[model samples]
Target: MNLLEEFKKNPGFVYRIGTDYYYIGKWICKPCTDEAVTDCHAMYEMCIQAKEPANAALYFQKLRAYSEFALDIPYNPAKILQYQTALVEALSDADIQSLTDQLRHFHDQAS
Candidate 1:
């Protein structure tokens, strides 16, 4: 029997691809959930640990995308805040200061 047939017969089969695990029919496997979460957390951590602001921002963007897909929900304030916190943490001190300054300038200009 083919893999599809096997999956239909027993849909519990999970396959690992690279660092991520996928279910038989492109579904998120139960066993992979924890691993996926851990991987995402690690990615976020790496972004925080990055020396370069650009690299950290790139990783934060990727992390946001991944979190969105994984969460599969509408715009939830709590979730958005969580991701924002992570992204903020990923920024270097200099970058954070610059961003804060820019935000303040923009706010002052708008007001």
Candidate 2:
């Protein structure tokens, strides 16, 4: 069975092709797409499990930095752009295409 079929049979399955991550037939990336927001969240959880209060606080702060709901402050446009630049700079052309495909799929579903 292929990755897609594996995901369909088990929704919880996580597939990785090198640094590329796929879940439920969708491509996902870190620090900008589906990972950072939860990357921080997962780190925070780990801190909690490790009983490190200071580290937990730091991770929580990182989590909030990526999300508006965690705080009332609006995101800085420059910072957002910087993040976009970094993400795009780090990805190859094929990676960008994968991300674009994911975005199109999301928009199509929303429409």
Candidate 3:
């Protein structure tokens, strides 16, 4: 099933910003996209914009899933590797740009 179909099957929580809905499972129709990656990226954007330490920590924790999710490599290395590969490729060009901008702003603030 596609992301939208998966979302329809299970109605998860929604986060809204103005008119935009950041609900990964529901609105996004991208067939190749992984739901976890989309959800993490969405939370990352919101956390960066909010400029709160707590949210920053949350985003960091979310990012750490890339490592945590791979901990079962001893049993099924190939499956985990494929998942990691897909997760790494899940970010779109716009997502990369937004992440870059957020990092730049953070650096500027630090300096």
Worst 10 residues of 3 by lDDT: 23-32
Off by over 4 Å in 3: 1-32, 67-99, 102-111
- Tally clashing residue pairs in candidate 3: 0
Cα lDDT tens digits for candidate 2, 15-65: 222355432221221232457555565565567668787786676555434
Summarize candidate 3's per-residue lDDT along 44-109 as a digit string, tens digits. 667767877677566555544432443332444345345434533565666545434544433343
For candidate 2, the clash count comes to 0
Candidate 1 lDDT over 1-111, as tens digits, reads: 133223233312223333443322222122245565556545544554564555545544554344335543343545434544454455566655644443332233224
Give the better candidate number (1 or 3) by TM-score.
3
**Candidate lDDT (C-alpha), each:** 0.40, 0.42, 0.42
Query: What does candidate 1 score in Cα RMSD to the true structure?
Result: 18.0
Error of 1 at 35 (Å): 34
Cα miss at 67, model 1 (Å)? 20
Query: Which structure among the candidates has the greatest TM-score?
Result: 2
lDDT for predicted candidate 3 compared with the true structure: 0.42
The better candidate by TM-score, 1 or 2, is: 2
Model 2 per-residue lDDT at 51: 75
TM-score ranking, best first: 2, 3, 1
Candidate 1 pairs with clashing backbones: none
RMSD for each model, in Å, please? 18.0, 13.0, 12.2
